[model samples]
Target: MHVLILGGTTEGRLLAGLLDGTVRVTSSLAGRVAAPRLPAGEVRIGGFGGPEGLAAWVRRHDVDAVIDATHPFAERISFNAARAAATAHVPLLVLRRPGWVPVAGDRWHEVGSLEEAAAALDGLGDRVFLTSGRLGLAAFADRPEWFLVRSVDAPDAPMPARSELLLDRGPFTLDGERGLLARHRIDVLVTKDSGGAATAPKLTAAREAAVPVVVVRRPPVPQGVPVASTPEEAAAWARALAG
Candidate 1:
């Protein structure tokens, strides 16, 4: 049995680790990051042209199933995978981690998109901690709020005029997050609901500091497709197929 994983996420990597050696697994990455953490399987980096191209590749490679385990905010690729899987007549599963829900003492402003997130930041506070990744910074570029843009890579132009870039990767500690918020004097945080435990300490810090957060809600996965919320669940699906 052969499986193609459209993966650039921790969950994807975990799934690959689970299925490697048991079945043939191939993981594809978009290669937007300078250096991405590799999964434990045959890995291909770059776009497969588009949906048509992806379908062609699936047919050519004789892929039995496809699991899209990309970032939750990766809206375009998810849709493309849906189309490709349907065209190729292979089973498709989307592995999206669950979104974070606000708890007691959490001030959450949930919006549908980055543009809306920028709007939600209006009057929320300045000194914004923008962690929605580098690509979406353009939406907040013209906003008057000063931004602390933290991303794995330094963002390109069209970022906020009064923003300072902080390049860092996640699995951030709560203490570290607390210190960062204090050092930057961040009053409001703008982030996507790209949910995971490693990337969630900042939310806790924000909550502890009584800071407001503007969360850009994740786009819905393409409809009529099976969805798994964990790598374990996705691995089970793959193993079932293999059996």
Candidate 2:
């Protein structure tokens, strides 16, 4: 059985590693990331040229099944993958980690998109800690009075009016994030609902500091697709389907 994994998240890598050698697995990565920790399997970087290209690849590669283990905010790719898989008549599975739930004292202001979050930032705070990734920075480009943008890689394009970019990886501690927040005097936090332990410390720090957060809610999942919460579950499902 041949399997293609639309991957970039930790869960995707873990799933690919688990399925290594058991099936002919190929992991597809969006090349936007710099220095990505790749999985143990055949790796293909960059986009598949949208739904048509992806469908063609599926047919050409003889992909029997596809596992979408991308980030929850990656809705476009997820939709394209679903369309492509359907076109190619291959089974599809989505591995999405559960979203973060607001705890007590968490000053959460959920928004549908980054533009809404940008509009909400007018009276909220002066200094902002943006963790909404690189692709959507244009939404805040015009409103960038001040911002401290953090990303795994420097944005491919230019940023907003006045902004400082911090190129780093996370799994940051609450104490560290709190210290940074204090030093920067950040009053507002902006992030996507990328629920995981690695980047979750910022939310805790924001809650402790009473800083209001503008969280971009996860994009809606494609209708009628099988979903799994963990790499193991996705792998098991793929194996069963292959059998």
Candidate 3:
């Protein structure tokens, strides 16, 4: 049986590794990220054209199952995967890591999108620490406000007025982030609910400094799909389908 994994996150890579050699597996990456960690399996980079393209690929590749393991905030790709799997009459499973929970000391103000977060910035702070990735920087471009944007790669589009780009990867230490917050005089932080330990230290730093954070809530999961939180559970589901 051949299984296709819609992958771009750590959970996706781990799932691919867990299923290595167990079944004929292929992993698809969006190719937007630079220097992505390769999973253990056949790997294909770039878009599958959209729903129709993905559907054709599923049929042509004789795929037996699919796992939607993209980032939680990757709503469009998840929708396309759901549509393609249904069109091909193939079983699909979604692997999503649980979101982070707020602790007492954390001052989190949840928003729906980048624009909303920008709108909420008025009362918060002038110096903003932005960790919302590189794609959606345009929403904040009109703000003309001061910001310290950090990303793995340099942002493609022009940034907001008076903004400084910091090229860095996360799994950053609390002390490091604290120094950044302090040195930049950042009083507010903005981030997506892309939950995981790797980029979570900033939240802790914000908490320490009593800085308010504007967290973009995660996009809703596609409805009526089998879901698993870990590679072991996903493997079990795949094995059941194989049987």
Candidate 4:
């Protein structure tokens, strides 16, 4: 049995590792990062064109099932996968990590888009920790506040005029996150609702520091794909389909 894992997230990597020996898994990455942490098994980098291209690849490779395990905010790829799976007549499963919910003492301002997040930041603070990744920095370009934009890779142009770029990856620790907020004197945080334990310590630090957070809500996933919240559940569904 063969499966194509549209992978890049930690969950995708975990699922691929789990199914490596038991099932034939081909993990595909978008190659946005300079050096991504690769999943075990057959891995391919770069785009598969679009939906039509992905469908062709599925047919050519005889893929039995597909798991759309890309990042939650990666709406374009998720939509393409949905279309490609339907065109190829392959069962598709979407594995999305659940979004974070605000708890007691958590000052979270949820917005629909990056532009809205930028709006939400107005008068919030001058020193901002923008952890919303590298793609949407253009929205904050004209803002008067200073920003500390952090991402896995250095971002492209149209970033904030008064911001500093920090290249890093997570599983960030609570102590480390708190230290950054303190050292940078960050009064506000801008981030996406990219829920996972890996980068969640920042949220905790913000809560502890009483810093307001502007969270850009994740874009809706393409409908009609069966969804799973965990890699274990996704693997189970794939196993059933592959069988």
lDDT (10s digit) by residue, model 3, range 6-70: 99888889888988888888999999888988999999999989999999999999999999999
Q: Is candidate 2 or candidate 4 better by lDDT?
A: 4
TM-score of each: 0.98, 0.96, 0.96, 0.98
Specify the poorest-scoring 10-residue window by lDDT in model 4.
Answer: 217-226
Show how many residue pairs clash in every candidate, following the order shown.
0, 0, 0, 0
Q: What does candidate 1's lDDT look like per residue over 65-138, in tens digits?
A: 99999999888899999999999999999999999999999999999988998888778997999998989778
Residue range 85-157, candidate 4, lDDT tens digits:
9999998999999999999999999999999999898789999999988897899999999999999999989
Regions more than 4 Å wrong, model 2 = none
Write down the worst ten-residue block by lDDT for model 3: 137-146
State the lDDT at 180 in candidate 2.
86
Error of 4 at 14 (Å): 0.4
Off by over 4 Å in 4: none
Cα deviation of 237, candidate 4, in Å: 0.7
lDDT for model 4, on a 0 to 1 scale?
0.94
lDDT of each: 0.93, 0.92, 0.91, 0.94
* Model 3 residue 201 distance off true place after TM-score fit, in angstroms: 0.8
